[model samples]
Target: MSASMDIRTKSLSKPVNVAQYLFTRLYQIGIRSVHGLPGDYNLVALDYLPECNLKWVGSVNELNASYAADGYARVKGISALITTFGVGELSAINGIAGAYSEMVPVVHIVGCPSTISQRNGMLLHHTLGNGDFNVFADMSASVSCAVAKLNDPAEVAAQIDHTLRECYIKSRPVYIMLPSDVVEDQVEGARLDTEIDLSIVENEPEREDYVVDLILKTLHSSKKAVVLADACAIRHRAVPELTAFLDKTNLPVFVTPMGKSAVDETKENYGGVYAGDASHPDVKALVEGADVVLAVGGLKSDFNTAGFSYKTSQLNTIDLHSDHCVVRYSEYPGVKMGGVLRKVTERLDMSKLSVQKIAHVGPQAVAEKLEGADQIIDQKWFWPRVSDFLKENDIVVTETGTANFGIWDTKFPKGVTGLNQVLWGSIGWAVGACQGAALGAKDAGSDRRTILFEGDGSFQLTAQEVSTMMRHDLNIILFVLCNDGYTIERFIHGEEAEYNDVVEWKYKELVTVFGGSEQRTKKYRVNNKGELDALLNDQDFNDRKGMRFVEVVMDRMDAPNSLRLTAEASAKNNARRE
Candidate 1:
């Protein structure tokens, strides 16, 4: 039925309040828990959550709440973030921007003053004192893909549907301003019967066919065609199709840093990570030497590409993006990669190609330790050794510091999903993300263990979030690398600089302070490789139950080879006057 018809049938079905309608939409889209804090403006709206079958996840602060929502969205496809008018929304902006940059879908709902007060221009406590109610929404509009001012009862549900649709389809953040008065505004309940369609718009059949034919023809002519998958392929949910393409062609698959663990490293054909100059010698040679590069969902930012040092030409690379596809210099707008990949995989004639090659340089093959393992924890020993502890179907959250760069050295078991702010480079984000992602994994009904590798300096910024995890009794494994300061920043510019240092905190004690007891949560401080190995080998510790925290003390200056190369390149790039 049409929207007009639904409105007419309101008497047949009991009308739902605006908050009820909004919360129902969120619940419908698999947001089991809503993340954010409550305020005077949003307090009334919280009452309707239980009735809508949605759990409220009140965080330590809006910033952490936003970060949690981003993480939740990453695991659960989309998440909802609730905040109050000005201060609350502003605090959450950084996290929202991170989600926007990384293509995580999060609906940011800002509960504002009543519509009457806005028209009267009354100065509110959270306001700028200028009586501009629209200012916060305007500020968030820059980072959000869609903005909805939900005041009118007639348009509220439709506005929410449209905004949420954009959030899911575009895989980015969207803003919804829900006024206090509108919290109880009546809307036709019949609208809830029909679910909102969130299907991506299909590419023009003829154009898609042409693109697929072109890609296959190019592949047929090339002897060395390699699949270079990146962030967008995962973000746009094209992994299944991309996997099929890889399998059909039997081409070697290499992932970018953002696309780490995208392809199963356990696969025989899985090539090592390829990030410009930072790539492994064998992987680098194979990728750069390839006649054709099938670049899928690529977001080649400076850090991701080792300061944009990629030698692969656009002419040699066929970039398959979320919205479009580019073959050499030709751009096909509205031609999505999912359908194109699916078609290409179906029509691909692998028989025409010479020796459908597999990767000889697989990361699955662990080399014997060249250095002694008796020494204290260092980047080289730590990252590779930790890989043995990881299980398949785990959700690993790496902080945007040394942890992010170091994790590249660790090959994940199959189905291990990785979460790191590669493009945004936001520190202190992992703690909150780990919490939400744990909840997201639980909601997904997948028995995926959630593990967090956080740098001490980065963990300090959002330390309070651990309390939220304790309160929820989430099953999590946390690793804090205590290197005394900002290791990533130190390598980038300020090594030994006082400004780069952060005060050392007892990580194990913090978990206790956050309400975790020895009986309930396990906390360990491992200073060396032997201690780490013993802890990992403990059968009780590997149970994947309760909150387990480990603090790893390491040399402040030591970093992964990928980080060292990328940081030096980044430093040189920054220093360039040209």
Candidate 2:
């Protein structure tokens, strides 16, 4: 036998190409689809996707692909995106940074030149004429929890597994550099037998028990206690524990803006959205007046906390976090929130807890307060009605403009998942994220509907993503709120500035222009409440199996109340102080 054949016969398992090994790892981790656009460097590797039964989602651009990947990861636990070296990876950086800031787990893979070319210092097309291949990898490391430059065949499998494990456990994006030549390099397939360790980091048992005891003692003595859940609760995958605590205590539960839909809003003990001064009057009174506050996975970003407007005292707050626990003045490091929450719930004494009485003050009660039912669609009436239109388990993706703030007054049905980039506040994220989230919902094997509400200005940034959704035949409903320009920007600095204005496109005609057939794509234009109501009430429109687009016209100056308040505070903070 030949030397190679003789060695192959004695191998513990058959050899697999680098692409096969990578795809198999992804598949084993529940990734049914791979998201990215094809570039020359990655084209050969793309051929190996179907070998492992992974569908390729070819997004319109690298930036949109990254955004879509973020959305997919938020829904499906983890997702992967691929791009060519410099140009492609740089375009996706903004989205990756957003994922890092918001703690979404996405795998960003960049395909680069062969080892020979890189070693020879060959100037690549995507390069900055510097003959440097390591620059992009270095830049990505800042935004990723871990990065793997897959160059050695001997260690490729281990590198991929370790990087993926970081992405999973940290719940943040990871970067992988896959060389074009490495795409076909042979690796030991036997390494796939050991699954990546994705278990949550454990806390020191003695410290954990002490923290739980302190929390219990504080809660038992408090005359009033409130639970405030935020984005990290969901990002760290601790919703079960958070919900259990809420259900057991029956304490008034509230959410920060970034933590929308973290808890079951349909529950009786639920209060309403709390974003400091931007909060509802009733919600503000309830949350600020608490004696002891239990904050779970709290992320107090500027806008999320209404420009640092929180009145809650840390002296009376017990902040539960992913890596540490804070009780009033004491801090317990390495004590992750998951274990602490689980322990707290397990040891919770129901009788010692001061249960809060329920009073209705959430999104559902806003309709009766809305006085006018004018034909013109106003922001006040539009959002509350959207709350009613939403169904359970629907994936709702909102833009960072008015849609993000407008959704504050909108209470979600049970099991609804909200996708938005509030901290990074990137524009044009929703369209791409909607495509990814819809695919994620489909991958989850649920009958969930994916819906998007984006300002015309924001949607125009990445409208091509909708075409990708059409290509996949995914069910999605896109609602474009046409109000002339960037509504959020208008409230911040430029109400009448020309910079915020955008060239309005015929939005309803986009589906057809994107090659949507009449049978698969539908469009509607509603300028008034009556027109919107008729379409919303139609059973046929509601049960459609394909893409649906609605252009709802509104006033240019009108903004959501939350947006106005947040913008006002932001504008004041921006100017030079006396």
Candidate 3:
């Protein structure tokens, strides 16, 4: 027998290639899809994406892709999209700008021509000036940060890491430029780092003792101190702490349109959605008559704050936000709202208050109101029925107008719901987000039901997403508020006639058109309250099997709650002038 000797040689650690390392790092950070259009310059990076389990999402256009990525990021926490050189990058600027304005973390990846090609002027797809690639660099100032070229392949590793980290820290968009040759070159020393932590900083700002004192004193002074949570507050997830404080003080809470679900709308202290709309006369009166208003997570956007009412001098307001900054009446530079709020109960006394005051108001009361309304017979009435069909864990996305307003009255037992408040406030967000949310829910290992309530106008905007839904055989329900007009626009511009209306379609027919066979789907249309009730009673549509579409015919003039307020305000303004 011959003895075998084992020989050991040290493994040489070559420099990691830039393209493979960065792509792998992105996958580690939960970037499942790289949205972009392919160009010759950036094809090298695109080729390496699939190796890291990253799929390329081709968009209709660069701008739309950016918006889609923004939407995806809004739902998934981090968003990234790639494009080739100047034209593609420039085309995507608007969506990126919108993301920046909304404080969404979207990383913009642009693939540039190689250093040699740029020097040689090879008529690249999007090359502009040879001496200066400053267009994107200039635009970066408006966003959070921007970088061009990995330059030295050695610096590629740290630069990519720093840029992404800062993007998450600032909670805004960042631009990264990748040179073609660098991605294609064999990396000799690069390394794939551990997952990037994209979590936003949760630090509360410094407190303003004076502001806190004023707020607490005012709360003690008034019989009712209304806490009006705006859109920003709700988006920041301040609900639990804010609700606890309000309950501790036995204070009433009301939210605007953007703040619709800030707290369970069915709670006793919940004054209802307060930005005018069709809320009860008593609820509206409560908001109008509140002694002191605590505006948390607010934005002075035209729609929510009464078209920019409560200016610095007009109202005594204390604003709180996730940014940790507080601005009182828009005059005071403000204290940190989040920080001051956290410490509020510590300094204040709340034991005197009755904890039982915070009972969950039943959905029956809302149902009664829906049943009693006579003027506008619309899908707004069907929401309670739909709400009943939904489990506590269902995720709901509403389109614009009556559909949105109807769902606004819905009280979720437990679950998440969202609508697009920015980027054109386009109608089809429900369908689009339905796809996104369904994908997200599936990935999160939850069996939560995903529901989309779409208005006629908004449903048509990105109805194509439904095709994607059918393609994946996702189990989702589509409830179409088929009033057949841009009802929200009609209310906003006060244009009850002309271009506001839309050509109606058989909403349920879309399923068949999109390849959902009879066995795989069910469809229904409810023209009256009786039919709606009957449809709600049917158990065939309850289970998550394939897909379903229920179209509820509503009156076009069934005005939303916000429009009602706008009209009354307009009437009052005209009367005052007269």
Cα RMSDs, all models: 2.6, 2.1, 6.7
Mind giving the per-residue lDDT tens digits that candidate 3 earns over 173-246? 88888888778544433245356665555442333666666666755655545677776654455666677676
What is the model-wide C-alpha lDDT for candidate 2? 0.89
lDDT per residue (tens digit) for residues 359-390 in model 2: 85856633434344446788888888888788
Candidate 1 wrong stretches, greater than 4 Å: 1-13, 355-373
What's the TM for model 2?
Answer: 0.97
Q: Is candidate 2 or candidate 3 better by TM-score?
A: 2
The better-scoring model by TM-score among 1 and 3 is: 1
lDDT of 1 by residue, 1-578 (tens): 44864564465456888999999999898899999999999999999999999989889999999999999999999999999999899999999999999999999999999999999999779998998999989999999999999977778888988999999999999999999998887877788998889898888999999999999889889888888999999999999998887676668889998998678888777888899998888889989998899999999999899889798988888999998999989999989999999999888776887544555573434434635556788887777777788888889999988888888778888899999899998899999999999989888776578999999999999999999887877889999999999998999988989999999888889888989867669899987777888898899999857799999989999998889999999999988995
Full-model lDDT for every candidate: 0.89, 0.89, 0.64
Arranged by lDDT with the best first, the candidates are: 2, 1, 3
Where is model 1 poorest over a 10-residue stretch in terms of lDDT?
362-371
